[model samples]
Target: MSTVNPNPSAAMLVIGDEILSGRTRDANMYYLAGELTKLGVDLKEVRVVSDDKNAIVSAVRALSTAYDHVFTSGGIGPTHDDITADCVAEAFGVSIDVRDDARVLLAAHYAARGAEFNAARMRMARIPDTATLIENPVSIAPGFTVQNVHVMAGVPNIFQAMVASVMPTLTGGSPLLSQTYRIDSPESTVAEPLGDLAARYPDLSMGSYPFTQDGAFGTNIVIRGVSGAQVEAAMIELANLFPRG
Candidate 1:
Protein backbone atom coordinates (compact mmCIF):
# COMPACT_ATOMS: atom_id res chain seq x y z
CA MET A 1 0.00 0.00 0.00
CA SER A 2 1.24 3.47 -0.92
CA THR A 3 0.97 6.21 1.64
CA VAL A 4 -0.38 9.48 0.33
CA ASN A 5 -0.07 12.72 2.23
CA PRO A 6 -3.47 14.35 2.26
CA ASN A 7 -2.22 17.89 2.78
CA PRO A 8 0.49 20.00 1.16
CA SER A 9 1.26 23.42 2.57
CA ALA A 10 1.95 26.73 0.79
CA ALA A 11 2.59 30.34 1.70
CA MET A 12 2.28 33.62 -0.20
CA LEU A 13 4.43 36.75 -0.21
CA VAL A 14 2.89 39.89 -1.68
CA ILE A 15 5.72 42.39 -2.26
CA GLY A 16 5.05 45.98 -3.21
CA ASP A 17 5.00 49.38 -1.56
CA GLU A 18 1.72 50.05 -3.34
CA ILE A 19 -0.05 47.23 -1.56
CA LEU A 20 1.35 48.26 1.80
CA SER A 21 0.65 51.96 1.24
CA GLY A 22 -2.97 51.29 0.23
CA ARG A 23 -2.39 52.43 -3.34
CA THR A 24 -3.06 48.94 -4.66
CA ARG A 25 -5.51 46.50 -3.13
CA ASP A 26 -4.18 42.92 -3.20
CA ALA A 27 -6.12 40.37 -5.25
CA ASN A 28 -3.40 37.73 -5.55
CA MET A 29 -3.58 36.51 -1.92
CA TYR A 30 -7.30 35.72 -2.09
CA TYR A 31 -6.98 34.29 -5.59
CA LEU A 32 -4.10 32.02 -4.56
CA ALA A 33 -5.78 30.85 -1.35
CA GLY A 34 -8.83 29.57 -3.25
CA GLU A 35 -6.76 27.94 -5.99
CA LEU A 36 -4.34 26.24 -3.58
CA THR A 37 -7.26 24.93 -1.53
CA LYS A 38 -8.74 23.34 -4.64
CA LEU A 39 -5.34 21.81 -5.40
CA GLY A 40 -5.18 20.34 -1.88
CA VAL A 41 -2.49 22.80 -0.86
CA ASP A 42 -3.29 24.46 2.43
CA LEU A 43 -2.28 28.12 2.38
CA LYS A 44 -0.96 28.52 5.89
CA GLU A 45 0.54 31.97 5.99
CA VAL A 46 0.53 35.20 3.97
CA ARG A 47 2.77 38.27 4.23
CA VAL A 48 2.39 41.66 2.58
CA VAL A 49 5.61 43.65 2.53
CA SER A 50 6.95 46.82 0.96
CA ASP A 51 9.33 46.99 -2.03
CA ASP A 52 12.34 47.04 0.25
CA LYS A 53 14.84 44.43 -0.89
CA ASN A 54 15.63 43.34 2.67
CA ALA A 55 11.97 42.76 3.39
CA ILE A 56 11.48 40.71 0.25
CA VAL A 57 14.60 38.64 0.87
CA SER A 58 13.68 37.98 4.48
CA ALA A 59 10.16 36.94 3.61
CA VAL A 60 11.30 34.71 0.76
CA ARG A 61 13.81 32.92 2.97
CA ALA A 62 11.37 32.42 5.83
CA LEU A 63 8.46 31.17 3.72
CA SER A 64 10.61 28.96 1.51
CA THR A 65 11.94 27.13 4.54
CA ALA A 66 8.55 26.82 6.24
CA TYR A 67 6.25 25.53 3.47
CA ASP A 68 6.21 23.12 0.57
CA HIS A 69 5.95 26.03 -1.83
CA VAL A 70 6.27 29.79 -1.61
CA PHE A 71 4.58 32.07 -4.14
CA THR A 72 5.57 35.70 -4.56
CA SER A 73 3.63 38.35 -6.47
CA GLY A 74 4.66 41.87 -7.47
CA GLY A 75 7.94 43.72 -8.38
CA ILE A 76 8.68 41.73 -11.54
CA GLY A 77 8.35 44.34 -14.24
CA PRO A 78 10.27 46.85 -16.40
CA THR A 79 9.97 49.90 -14.18
CA HIS A 80 12.77 51.28 -12.02
CA ASP A 81 11.05 50.07 -8.86
CA ASP A 82 10.82 46.49 -10.11
CA ILE A 83 13.38 44.47 -8.11
CA THR A 84 11.81 41.10 -7.37
CA ALA A 85 14.16 39.12 -9.57
CA ASP A 86 17.20 40.61 -7.88
CA CYS A 87 15.80 40.11 -4.41
CA VAL A 88 14.88 36.51 -5.17
CA ALA A 89 18.38 35.90 -6.46
CA GLU A 90 19.91 37.35 -3.33
CA ALA A 91 17.70 35.20 -1.15
CA PHE A 92 19.06 32.06 -2.80
CA GLY A 93 22.66 33.31 -3.01
CA VAL A 94 22.47 33.33 -6.82
CA SER A 95 23.50 36.03 -9.25
CA ILE A 96 20.90 37.51 -11.61
CA ASP A 97 21.47 38.99 -15.06
CA VAL A 98 19.64 39.46 -18.36
CA ARG A 99 20.29 36.09 -19.96
CA ASP A 100 20.39 35.65 -23.73
CA ASP A 101 17.37 33.32 -23.76
CA ALA A 102 15.09 35.72 -21.95
CA ARG A 103 16.48 38.72 -23.83
CA VAL A 104 15.93 37.04 -27.19
CA LEU A 105 12.34 36.24 -26.31
CA LEU A 106 11.68 39.83 -25.23
CA ALA A 107 13.44 41.19 -28.28
CA ALA A 108 11.35 39.11 -30.65
CA HIS A 109 8.16 40.16 -28.88
CA TYR A 110 8.97 43.88 -29.15
CA ALA A 111 10.21 43.60 -32.73
CA ALA A 112 6.93 42.01 -33.83
CA ARG A 113 5.09 45.02 -32.45
CA GLY A 114 7.51 47.47 -34.16
CA ALA A 115 8.65 48.66 -30.75
CA GLU A 116 12.10 49.38 -29.40
CA PHE A 117 13.75 46.82 -27.11
CA ASN A 118 15.27 49.57 -25.00
CA ALA A 119 17.39 49.13 -21.87
CA ALA A 120 14.50 49.72 -19.50
CA ARG A 121 12.41 47.10 -21.25
CA MET A 122 15.32 44.66 -21.18
CA ARG A 123 15.17 44.82 -17.41
CA MET A 124 12.30 42.35 -17.60
CA ALA A 125 14.73 39.68 -18.79
CA ARG A 126 16.83 39.77 -15.62
CA ILE A 127 16.34 36.28 -14.20
CA PRO A 128 18.41 34.59 -11.53
CA ASP A 129 20.96 31.99 -12.59
CA THR A 130 19.25 29.46 -10.33
CA ALA A 131 15.74 30.14 -11.61
CA THR A 132 13.58 28.91 -14.48
CA LEU A 133 11.37 31.25 -16.44
CA ILE A 134 7.61 31.26 -15.84
CA GLU A 135 5.58 31.76 -19.02
CA ASN A 136 3.36 34.79 -19.21
CA PRO A 137 0.67 34.42 -21.88
CA VAL A 138 -0.70 37.89 -21.21
CA SER A 139 2.64 39.72 -21.68
CA ILE A 140 6.07 38.76 -22.94
CA ALA A 141 7.86 39.56 -19.68
CA PRO A 142 8.55 36.31 -17.85
CA GLY A 143 8.37 35.40 -14.16
CA PHE A 144 10.83 32.96 -12.60
CA THR A 145 11.07 30.23 -9.99
CA VAL A 146 14.00 29.47 -7.72
CA GLN A 147 13.85 26.30 -5.67
CA ASN A 148 10.36 26.25 -4.11
CA VAL A 149 9.79 29.96 -4.65
CA HIS A 150 7.74 31.23 -7.60
CA VAL A 151 8.00 34.89 -8.56
CA MET A 152 5.08 36.38 -10.48
CA ALA A 153 3.75 39.64 -11.82
CA GLY A 154 1.66 42.09 -9.82
CA VAL A 155 -0.95 42.87 -12.47
CA PRO A 156 -4.01 40.73 -11.91
CA ASN A 157 -4.11 39.42 -15.48
CA ILE A 158 -0.44 38.54 -15.72
CA PHE A 159 -0.32 37.15 -12.20
CA GLN A 160 -3.20 34.80 -13.05
CA ALA A 161 -1.47 33.79 -16.26
CA MET A 162 1.75 32.92 -14.44
CA VAL A 163 -0.22 30.85 -11.96
CA ALA A 164 -1.82 28.86 -14.76
CA SER A 165 1.63 28.24 -16.17
CA VAL A 166 3.04 27.05 -12.85
CA MET A 167 0.14 24.88 -11.69
CA PRO A 168 0.77 22.10 -14.18
CA THR A 169 4.22 21.44 -12.72
CA LEU A 170 2.93 20.95 -9.19
CA THR A 171 1.88 17.67 -7.59
CA GLY A 172 -1.41 17.90 -5.73
CA GLY A 173 -2.60 15.47 -3.10
CA SER A 174 -6.25 14.60 -2.45
CA PRO A 175 -8.51 17.55 -3.24
CA LEU A 176 -9.79 19.30 -0.14
CA LEU A 177 -13.49 18.44 0.01
CA SER A 178 -16.13 20.42 1.91
CA GLN A 179 -19.84 20.60 2.65
CA THR A 180 -21.86 23.45 4.11
CA TYR A 181 -25.01 23.36 6.26
CA ARG A 182 -27.05 26.50 6.64
CA ILE A 183 -29.11 26.72 9.80
CA ASP A 184 -31.75 29.38 10.32
CA SER A 185 -30.65 29.98 13.87
CA PRO A 186 -28.35 32.48 15.51
CA GLU A 187 -24.88 31.14 16.15
CA SER A 188 -25.39 31.53 19.92
CA THR A 189 -28.17 28.95 19.70
CA VAL A 190 -26.00 26.25 18.12
CA ALA A 191 -22.49 27.11 19.33
CA GLU A 192 -22.40 24.37 21.89
CA PRO A 193 -23.53 21.63 19.55
CA LEU A 194 -21.13 22.83 16.86
CA GLY A 195 -18.24 22.81 19.33
CA ASP A 196 -19.14 19.30 20.37
CA LEU A 197 -19.30 18.14 16.78
CA ALA A 198 -15.82 19.60 16.08
CA ALA A 199 -14.37 17.91 19.14
CA ARG A 200 -15.73 14.54 18.07
CA TYR A 201 -14.10 14.70 14.63
CA PRO A 202 -10.53 15.79 15.11
CA ASP A 203 -9.63 15.13 11.46
CA LEU A 204 -12.31 17.47 10.21
CA SER A 205 -12.30 21.26 10.30
CA MET A 206 -15.62 22.80 11.28
CA GLY A 207 -16.31 26.48 10.82
CA SER A 208 -19.30 28.67 11.56
CA TYR A 209 -20.06 31.66 9.38
CA PRO A 210 -22.75 34.06 10.51
CA PHE A 211 -24.82 36.24 8.24
CA THR A 212 -27.76 38.62 8.40
CA GLN A 213 -30.36 38.53 5.64
CA ASP A 214 -33.62 40.50 5.67
CA GLY A 215 -32.99 41.31 9.33
CA ALA A 216 -32.90 37.64 10.24
CA PHE A 217 -29.76 36.07 11.74
CA GLY A 218 -28.38 32.72 10.67
CA THR A 219 -25.19 30.67 10.55
CA ASN A 220 -23.54 28.65 7.81
CA ILE A 221 -21.63 25.69 9.16
CA VAL A 222 -18.93 24.18 6.99
CA ILE A 223 -17.28 20.83 7.51
CA ARG A 224 -14.07 20.08 5.63
CA GLY A 225 -11.86 17.03 5.58
CA VAL A 226 -9.67 15.11 3.19
CA SER A 227 -11.78 11.96 3.29
CA GLY A 228 -15.34 11.90 1.98
CA ALA A 229 -16.27 9.31 4.58
CA GLN A 230 -15.02 11.49 7.40
CA VAL A 231 -16.80 14.57 6.10
CA GLU A 232 -20.05 12.66 5.56
CA ALA A 233 -19.90 11.09 9.00
CA ALA A 234 -19.46 14.50 10.57
CA MET A 235 -22.27 15.89 8.44
CA ILE A 236 -24.55 13.12 9.69
CA GLU A 237 -23.84 14.05 13.27
CA LEU A 238 -24.42 17.71 12.50
CA ALA A 239 -27.78 17.01 10.87
CA ASN A 240 -28.90 14.73 13.69
CA LEU A 241 -28.15 17.44 16.20
CA PHE A 242 -30.11 20.06 14.26
CA PRO A 243 -32.91 17.61 13.32
CA ARG A 244 -34.58 19.37 10.42
CA GLY A 245 -38.41 19.41 10.41
Candidate 2:
Protein backbone atom coordinates (compact mmCIF):
# COMPACT_ATOMS: atom_id res chain seq x y z
CA MET A 1 0.00 0.00 0.00
CA SER A 2 1.21 3.52 -0.86
CA THR A 3 1.38 6.06 1.92
CA VAL A 4 0.08 9.60 1.35
CA ASN A 5 1.70 12.79 2.56
CA PRO A 6 -1.01 15.18 3.73
CA ASN A 7 0.86 18.33 2.77
CA PRO A 8 4.11 19.43 1.15
CA SER A 9 6.10 21.79 3.39
CA ALA A 10 7.22 25.31 2.41
CA ALA A 11 9.26 28.23 3.74
CA MET A 12 9.35 31.91 2.73
CA LEU A 13 12.18 34.45 2.69
CA VAL A 14 11.22 38.12 2.65
CA ILE A 15 14.18 40.18 1.40
CA GLY A 16 14.55 43.93 1.71
CA ASP A 17 16.23 46.64 3.79
CA GLU A 18 12.96 48.59 3.73
CA ILE A 19 11.21 45.75 5.54
CA LEU A 20 13.89 45.50 8.25
CA SER A 21 13.82 49.28 8.77
CA GLY A 22 10.00 49.26 8.99
CA ARG A 23 9.78 51.62 6.03
CA THR A 24 7.73 48.99 4.20
CA ARG A 25 5.50 46.31 5.68
CA ASP A 26 5.38 42.80 4.23
CA ALA A 27 2.02 41.43 3.04
CA ASN A 28 3.35 38.61 0.88
CA MET A 29 3.87 36.15 3.72
CA TYR A 30 0.29 36.58 4.86
CA TYR A 31 -1.05 36.08 1.34
CA LEU A 32 1.24 33.11 0.69
CA ALA A 33 0.21 31.42 3.95
CA GLY A 34 -3.49 31.56 3.14
CA GLU A 35 -2.98 30.39 -0.44
CA LEU A 36 -0.66 27.57 0.63
CA THR A 37 -3.07 26.40 3.30
CA LYS A 38 -5.90 26.17 0.78
CA LEU A 39 -3.60 24.46 -1.74
CA GLY A 40 -2.50 21.97 0.98
CA VAL A 41 1.14 23.11 1.03
CA ASP A 42 2.06 23.70 4.66
CA LEU A 43 4.04 26.92 5.21
CA LYS A 44 6.33 25.89 8.04
CA GLU A 45 8.65 28.90 8.42
CA VAL A 46 9.33 32.47 7.32
CA ARG A 47 12.54 34.50 7.52
CA VAL A 48 13.14 38.18 6.75
CA VAL A 49 16.59 39.29 5.61
CA SER A 50 17.99 42.65 4.53
CA ASP A 51 19.51 43.56 1.15
CA ASP A 52 22.94 42.28 2.16
CA LYS A 53 24.19 39.68 -0.32
CA ASN A 54 25.68 37.41 2.36
CA ALA A 55 22.49 37.38 4.39
CA ILE A 56 20.29 36.70 1.34
CA VAL A 57 22.57 33.92 0.07
CA SER A 58 22.79 32.21 3.47
CA ALA A 59 19.03 32.35 3.98
CA VAL A 60 18.35 31.04 0.48
CA ARG A 61 20.73 28.09 0.93
CA ALA A 62 19.35 27.23 4.36
CA LEU A 63 15.65 27.49 3.51
CA SER A 64 15.98 25.64 0.20
CA THR A 65 17.62 22.74 2.00
CA ALA A 66 15.17 22.62 4.89
CA TYR A 67 11.84 22.91 3.06
CA ASP A 68 10.23 21.18 0.08
CA HIS A 69 9.73 24.65 -1.49
CA VAL A 70 11.27 28.06 -0.75
CA PHE A 71 9.65 31.31 -1.88
CA THR A 72 11.52 34.62 -1.83
CA SER A 73 10.06 38.10 -2.22
CA GLY A 74 11.78 41.48 -2.81
CA GLY A 75 15.18 42.82 -3.99
CA ILE A 76 14.73 41.92 -7.67
CA GLY A 77 14.00 45.42 -8.88
CA PRO A 78 15.90 47.80 -11.20
CA THR A 79 17.61 49.82 -8.44
CA HIS A 80 21.12 49.51 -7.00
CA ASP A 81 19.79 47.74 -3.93
CA ASP A 82 18.06 45.00 -5.89
CA ILE A 83 20.55 42.15 -5.42
CA THR A 84 18.36 39.09 -4.79
CA ALA A 85 19.06 37.56 -8.18
CA ASP A 86 22.83 37.77 -7.64
CA CYS A 87 22.58 36.40 -4.11
CA VAL A 88 20.41 33.50 -5.24
CA ALA A 89 22.90 32.77 -8.01
CA GLU A 90 25.75 32.72 -5.49
CA ALA A 91 23.82 30.42 -3.19
CA PHE A 92 23.32 27.86 -5.99
CA GLY A 93 26.86 28.26 -7.39
CA VAL A 94 25.49 29.26 -10.77
CA SER A 95 26.46 31.95 -13.29
CA ILE A 96 24.00 34.82 -13.80
CA ASP A 97 23.49 37.60 -16.36
CA VAL A 98 20.71 39.36 -18.21
CA ARG A 99 19.25 36.46 -20.13
CA ASP A 100 18.02 37.30 -23.67
CA ASP A 101 14.45 36.12 -23.20
CA ALA A 102 13.91 38.06 -19.98
CA ARG A 103 15.52 41.14 -21.51
CA VAL A 104 13.27 40.87 -24.53
CA LEU A 105 10.19 40.67 -22.33
CA LEU A 106 11.13 43.79 -20.39
CA ALA A 107 12.25 45.62 -23.51
CA ALA A 108 8.92 45.05 -25.21
CA HIS A 109 7.02 46.03 -22.10
CA TYR A 110 8.91 49.32 -21.84
CA ALA A 111 8.68 50.02 -25.57
CA ALA A 112 4.90 49.59 -25.58
CA ARG A 113 4.60 51.95 -22.63
CA GLY A 114 6.84 54.56 -24.37
CA ALA A 115 9.44 54.22 -21.61
CA GLU A 116 13.19 53.82 -21.80
CA PHE A 117 14.69 50.34 -21.49
CA ASN A 118 17.83 51.77 -19.94
CA ALA A 119 20.65 50.07 -18.09
CA ALA A 120 18.96 50.30 -14.67
CA ARG A 121 15.66 49.03 -16.04
CA MET A 122 17.47 46.17 -17.78
CA ARG A 123 18.74 45.01 -14.37
CA MET A 124 15.42 43.19 -13.88
CA ALA A 125 16.43 40.74 -16.61
CA ARG A 126 19.38 39.31 -14.73
CA ILE A 127 18.55 35.70 -14.01
CA PRO A 128 20.57 32.65 -12.90
CA ASP A 129 21.45 30.43 -15.85
CA THR A 130 19.77 27.19 -14.81
CA ALA A 131 16.49 28.70 -13.71
CA THR A 132 13.06 28.86 -15.33
CA LEU A 133 11.11 32.13 -15.45
CA ILE A 134 8.02 32.70 -13.33
CA GLU A 135 5.58 34.83 -15.33
CA ASN A 136 4.45 38.19 -13.99
CA PRO A 137 1.09 39.17 -15.41
CA VAL A 138 0.79 42.29 -13.27
CA SER A 139 4.19 43.58 -14.37
CA ILE A 140 6.15 42.28 -17.33
CA ALA A 141 9.30 41.81 -15.27
CA PRO A 142 9.32 38.08 -14.60
CA GLY A 143 10.38 36.19 -11.49
CA PHE A 144 12.38 32.95 -11.72
CA THR A 145 12.63 29.56 -10.03
CA VAL A 146 16.02 28.05 -9.24
CA GLN A 147 15.83 24.46 -8.09
CA ASN A 148 13.37 24.56 -5.17
CA VAL A 149 13.57 28.31 -4.53
CA HIS A 150 11.12 30.67 -6.27
CA VAL A 151 12.14 34.34 -6.56
CA MET A 152 9.34 36.94 -6.83
CA ALA A 153 8.94 40.71 -6.81
CA GLY A 154 8.28 42.62 -3.58
CA VAL A 155 5.26 44.71 -4.55
CA PRO A 156 2.15 43.21 -2.94
CA ASN A 157 0.09 43.01 -6.13
CA ILE A 158 3.06 41.77 -8.12
CA PHE A 159 3.96 39.26 -5.44
CA GLN A 160 0.37 38.04 -5.39
CA ALA A 161 0.36 37.77 -9.17
CA MET A 162 3.65 35.86 -9.16
CA VAL A 163 2.27 33.52 -6.51
CA ALA A 164 -0.76 32.93 -8.73
CA SER A 165 1.58 32.13 -11.62
CA VAL A 166 3.58 29.70 -9.51
CA MET A 167 0.73 27.96 -7.69
CA PRO A 168 -0.60 25.98 -10.61
CA THR A 169 2.78 24.31 -11.15
CA LEU A 170 3.18 22.95 -7.62
CA THR A 171 1.92 19.56 -6.42
CA GLY A 172 -0.53 19.90 -3.54
CA GLY A 173 -1.72 17.39 -0.94
CA SER A 174 -4.98 16.74 0.98
CA PRO A 175 -6.79 19.83 2.24
CA LEU A 176 -6.42 20.54 5.96
CA LEU A 177 -9.76 20.71 7.79
CA SER A 178 -10.44 22.80 10.88
CA GLN A 179 -13.16 23.92 13.34
CA THR A 180 -13.22 26.77 15.88
CA TYR A 181 -15.15 27.15 19.15
CA ARG A 182 -15.32 30.28 21.29
CA ILE A 183 -15.42 29.90 25.06
CA ASP A 184 -16.33 32.87 27.27
CA SER A 185 -13.57 32.09 29.77
CA PRO A 186 -9.98 33.12 30.32
CA GLU A 187 -7.08 30.97 29.13
CA SER A 188 -6.16 30.30 32.76
CA THR A 189 -9.61 28.82 33.29
CA VAL A 190 -9.51 26.79 30.07
CA ALA A 191 -5.88 25.56 30.05
CA GLU A 192 -6.15 22.40 32.11
CA PRO A 193 -9.18 21.03 30.30
CA LEU A 194 -7.88 22.07 26.90
CA GLY A 195 -4.56 20.35 27.56
CA ASP A 196 -6.34 17.18 28.63
CA LEU A 197 -8.47 17.25 25.50
CA ALA A 198 -5.39 17.87 23.29
CA ALA A 199 -3.61 14.94 24.86
CA ARG A 200 -6.45 12.66 23.87
CA TYR A 201 -6.37 13.76 20.23
CA PRO A 202 -2.73 13.12 19.29
CA ASP A 203 -3.33 13.36 15.53
CA LEU A 204 -5.16 16.68 15.68
CA SER A 205 -3.66 20.14 16.36
CA MET A 206 -5.49 22.15 19.00
CA GLY A 207 -4.71 25.78 19.76
CA SER A 208 -6.07 28.33 22.22
CA TYR A 209 -6.21 31.99 21.26
CA PRO A 210 -7.03 34.39 24.08
CA PHE A 211 -8.85 37.68 23.58
CA THR A 212 -10.23 40.49 25.72
CA GLN A 213 -13.59 41.68 24.47
CA ASP A 214 -15.53 44.46 26.24
CA GLY A 215 -13.69 43.88 29.56
CA ALA A 216 -14.37 40.16 29.41
CA PHE A 217 -11.75 37.50 28.76
CA GLY A 218 -12.37 34.65 26.34
CA THR A 219 -10.60 31.85 24.49
CA ASN A 220 -11.08 30.58 20.98
CA ILE A 221 -10.16 26.92 20.56
CA VAL A 222 -9.22 25.77 17.08
CA ILE A 223 -8.96 22.11 16.19
CA ARG A 224 -7.23 21.17 12.95
CA GLY A 225 -6.62 17.81 11.28
CA VAL A 226 -6.48 16.23 7.84
CA SER A 227 -9.37 13.96 8.76
CA GLY A 228 -12.66 15.87 9.10
CA ALA A 229 -14.22 13.06 11.16
CA GLN A 230 -11.34 13.12 13.65
CA VAL A 231 -11.52 16.91 13.99
CA GLU A 232 -15.31 16.75 14.49
CA ALA A 233 -14.91 14.03 17.14
CA ALA A 234 -12.36 16.08 19.10
CA MET A 235 -14.48 19.21 18.76
CA ILE A 236 -17.52 17.32 20.13
CA GLU A 237 -15.53 16.15 23.14
CA LEU A 238 -14.15 19.68 23.69
CA ALA A 239 -17.69 21.18 23.64
CA ASN A 240 -18.90 18.55 26.05
CA LEU A 241 -16.01 19.19 28.44
CA PHE A 242 -16.40 22.98 28.33
CA PRO A 243 -20.14 23.61 28.00
CA ARG A 244 -21.04 27.29 27.49
CA GLY A 245 -22.16 28.86 30.75
Per-model TM against the reference: 0.95, 0.96
- Regions more than 4 Å wrong, model 2: 1-5
lDDT of 1 at 218: 89
Clash pairs (backbone) in predicted model 1 = none
lDDT, candidate 2, at 52 = 93
Q: In model 1, which runs have C-alpha deviations exceeding 4 angstroms? A: 1-5
Q: What are the per-residue Cα lDDT tens digits for candidate 2 across 75-188?
A: 999999999999999999999999999999999999999999999988999999999999999889999999999999999999999999999999998777779999999999
lDDT against the true structure, per candidate, is 0.90, 0.92
Candidate 1 lDDT over residue span 1-245, tens digit each: 12234677899999899988888889999899888888988888999998898999999999999999999999998998998899999999999899888898999999999999999999999999968889998888999899999999999999999999999898887787899998888999989999878887887888899999999998999988888998899899899888775
Give the clash total for candidate 2.
Answer: 0
- Could you report the Cα RMSD, in angstroms, for every candidate shown? 2.9, 2.7
Q: Positional deviation of 117 in candidate 1, in angstroms?
A: 0.4
Q: What does the lDDT come to for candidate 1?
A: 0.90
Most accurate candidate by lDDT: 2
Candidate 2 has its poorest 10 consecutive residues by lDDT at 1-10
